[model samples]
Target: MLMETPRLVGAFACLEYSFPFVTMARRWFVTATGIQVRRFVPNDEQGVSALILPIQREEFGIPITAEDQPDLKAIPTFYQIGTGDFWVAVQGDHVVGSIALKDIGSGQAALRKMFVAAPFRGKEFSIAARLLDRLIEESTRKGVTEVFLGTTDKFLAAHRFYEKHGFQEIAKEDLPASFPLIAVDSKFYVLGLNPE
Candidate 1:
């Protein structure tokens, strides 16, 4: 049976079963620039992939395939487990950006898969900031005391963006044992959350 629930413009909601096996999709209203950041749903797999993969491979010249990144293939299984969560910034039906937090235990999490499409980036859209804010807010609520992330030095703009948002660069040896360090990760950063 199909069920309807009232949801806030940009809020996430549980899936509603329509035909015993079919799931009804949840929709979020258009925000200021016709974009809304919300939690990942199964239907978002393709959109998320389209938004992230090309940026990682084509734009950055990373010699990697989607297969090498298991998290991208199964976001819910990889990110939604434990305190981890993944989010996507959607402009209408297209996913324009994405960010994920992978809980690494000990009140800590690993930030991953942060990518914004070229058209949606910059100060006007602030898509990256929105995605980061959502992830940080959710992480704080789940008692994640610290968040770590690894990135390639090639991402100079990303480095500046992360630092601008209070992430401090740290050495490889400083990373938590559970932080998943990918082969391409040459630079690392950490953000400490204040319980206050």
Candidate 2:
């Protein structure tokens, strides 16, 4: 008989991963949440964008002019070339979160724009951790040596999350005018994906 437990303190939406090939998908199955890690696809654009946009607005206090176009461009630049890629966290029919590995050469990739929806933010769901795990696996598959990411000073929660995932703070720098926000405060993180 299945037991119904009390509401988990921070239970977020459930993530289920399905891959076309059983073998490839099995290799990256995370037992903790049973989220099977897989490669991102073109159809994930809208779901992934929805998961990330509000966080961007909150962090930078700016708006995305055209959501579909920006995400659409990334399909060819990041996912298609095989140099970099991303993975999405899906539960039922809805996408809860996503993380991308941006190849920056020298066997290095950057973990960019990870976000879980407001309704599903916390440790119990393990969204961030699981996504990073999948990203590291993808980097290893693509022969990437290391990954780096940049965050703003305003995102203390994100900084903490990165730290928990073994990302170390290396530097802080100015934000280019091209970025949506006019703020100059930004922080950088470096993480070695290879296990010791």
Candidate 3:
């Protein structure tokens, strides 16, 4: 004998006990949601641009365009070379977020291009955290001892997130000589990987 139990079907709390086996069985059925974080490929240029440009320009009111950011136009050559790497978060066929690490040498790298689509943010989705985790794992594997980042004061949420993830705020002048300080970046941070 199988017992029937209510199943949740969305916004409305409707009790559905149509399938008794589905309620009685201890087996779990996992479905693919098509969300993934992966390395950047040449084919992702358009999707990456589509995902990042609006956030930087329209949302934040940054004057820069996608064309002005050469890195977005040449991810493979600019980010995939040496110890540098770039990753994107995708749902189905749409790119939702992106993060990149730039090898500045001296056991250090610069974190850049951290962006998440408006619809895919927050702890429930964890898209930003996944992107950052991927970058940090890759950095450690590549022997990067420190990871530095630069951002504008406008990104208050980003500041809190970075701080929560162990990135200590640092003075701009303290950045590595090789760290590329963009014009819009007024705040800086560094995360030391190696035990010091």
Worst 10-residue lDDT window for candidate 3 reads 23-32
Task: Kindly report which residue stretches of model 1 are placed more than 4 angstroms away from their true locations once superposed.
Answer: 1-32
- My TM-score estimates for the predictions, one after another, are 0.83, 0.68, 0.82
In candidate 3, what are the lDDT values of residues 29-70, reduced to their tens digit?
112255699999888787787667767776788887765899
For lDDT, the strongest prediction is 1
Structure candidate 3, residue pairs in collision: none
- Residues 1-196 of candidate 1: C-alpha lDDT, one tens digit per residue: 2222223333332222244677566453334467889999999987777667667876788987777887887999999989899999987777778999998999999999999866566887889999999998998888889999999989999999999999999999999999998999999999999643
Error of 3 at 163 (Å): 0.4
Rank ordering of all candidates by lDDT, starting from the highest? 1, 3, 2
Q: Give the best candidate by TM-score.
A: 1
CA-RMSD of model 1: 9.1
lDDT (Cα atoms) of all candidates against the true structure: 0.82, 0.59, 0.79
Q: Candidate 2 on 69-172: residue-level lDDT in tens?
A: 36444754655455578777775545667777766666766676677664455766677788888887778877876677776777789899889878888744
lDDT of 3 at 44: 79
Deviating ranges (above 4 Å) for candidate 3: 1-32
